[model samples]
Target: MDTITLWELVALAGAATLVGFSKTAVSGANTVSLAIFAAVLPARESTGILLPLLIVGDMFAVRAYRRHADWATLVRLFPAVAAGVVAGTVFMLWADDAAVRTSIGVILLVMASITVWRRRTAGQQAREQKGQGEEEGRGEPAGEGRQRARLKAGSYGVLGGFTTMVANAGGPVMSMYLLSAGFRKLGFLGTSAWFFLIVNVAKVPFSVGLGLIDRHSLLLDAGLALCVVPGAFLGRAVVDRINQRLFERLVIAATVVGGLQLLLR
Candidate 1:
């Protein structure tokens, strides 16, 4: 581990606050924290150190919105996500830090694109089906809706697992999916809070095996975790005021920008 200078500590504090804010309020912005961590620490070590800080933020989130989770959706996605975690572990074992960072960037960009395209196409399909149904004197069809849900769950699950393992960047990917699925307000926050808490907790063994978490990293995580408290409180206050559609669009845009930087850097 490198010696932490005063300036780097300040940066880490700022970044940690942003991370807590992003985790509970606006998620896509956590890229700021990711970049700061990578800048201040070695890439491999950064992920390990950041994980505990993230879990601290997650604790705040879970406390704020624990009552509104959708267990069924989480259960449906669990198996595929587990598969993704295994795949991510394999990739991390073999790939160098640069490769892992670049891969995560590319994955984030691709996932963002898929989410945008999916939203547009789904809207068009829904509109077209609605028109057709009016001509047939029927109500909105259930089959089309089911097909959309299935496609969304599968795509989101794969991307979420990959980005999370590689960069701890699953927030935006899952946020996009939950937003599209029409989870409103507290439900979105609650569901996302629990989902990430579980997934991140499950990742501990893999991170430990990869040597990402170490004694020094744990020390850093402790200092960073303190900054999460203020940010998390502010996030809880503002979460209900957020407009779901607009927040999601901003998240997608931020994810693309961050992903591109990671890839190109």
Candidate 2:
């Protein structure tokens, strides 16, 4: 195939920056990169092109917040995520592009809805718990904490697996989950860094199996990866300044809009 057009190459570089920024600042905006890839390349090949870029983004993410991850969270979520990945891979084998896109869109919508509803509920519960003269600063009871953890692991794991395999859209899935899990700034970044690092790397073999990554894709990835460094630097500067609550809300809203776009297109 001929090299990508000049406009397309510029678009790819822009999208790569967005991918890096999403990894650090706002997770859902990686959809911008996904859309760029789909616009320039065949849908399946888009996955290949996006995968290595994501891995590069993940490295930057891990380096920025390497010390804050909670190992327990990663361990708790991996098995379920693995199952979801297998299911997603199988789904990809049978599902057409439209079918896959629609499915991913639907899944994202549901995940966004759930994230919003749970956040509202948690906020209300936090208010109630604060007013009830029970726990002063602590938000919820022990049971509620366990319940939330389980729900986060299960829901986010499955959704992350499905979206990542289908469209590399798992970033928002885990972002919502980690936000709900109430990890503070560095912890959230670190945990997410480790999580996606392991998961994305694991996906390499499966991506190859699906013909989503190959020699040509690697060449493209090498060029695109160079752009992630500056993006990562810019994202790191902004990450702490971001209002975590507002960012999560925006992510949910953006994810919903992206889902609608996928469905309509």
Instruction: Give lDDT tens digits, candidate 1, residues 185-208.
Output: 567777888998999999998999
lDDT of 2 by residue, 84-187 (tens): 89988998788776776677567667767766776677675445444444321112244556777687688779878878888887876786676555555567
Off by over 4 Å in 1: 111-151, 241-261
Return the top candidate by TM-score. Answer: 2
- lDDT (0-100) at residue 190 of candidate 2? 85
> What TM-score does each of the candidates earn?
0.81, 0.82
- Candidate 1 to native Cα RMSD, angstroms: 5.4
Evaluate residue 4 in candidate 2 and report its C-alpha lDDT on the 0 to 100 scale.
Answer: 82
Q: For each candidate in the order shown, give its overall lDDT on alpha carbons.
A: 0.76, 0.76
Specify the poorest-scoring 10-residue window by lDDT in model 2.
Answer: 132-141
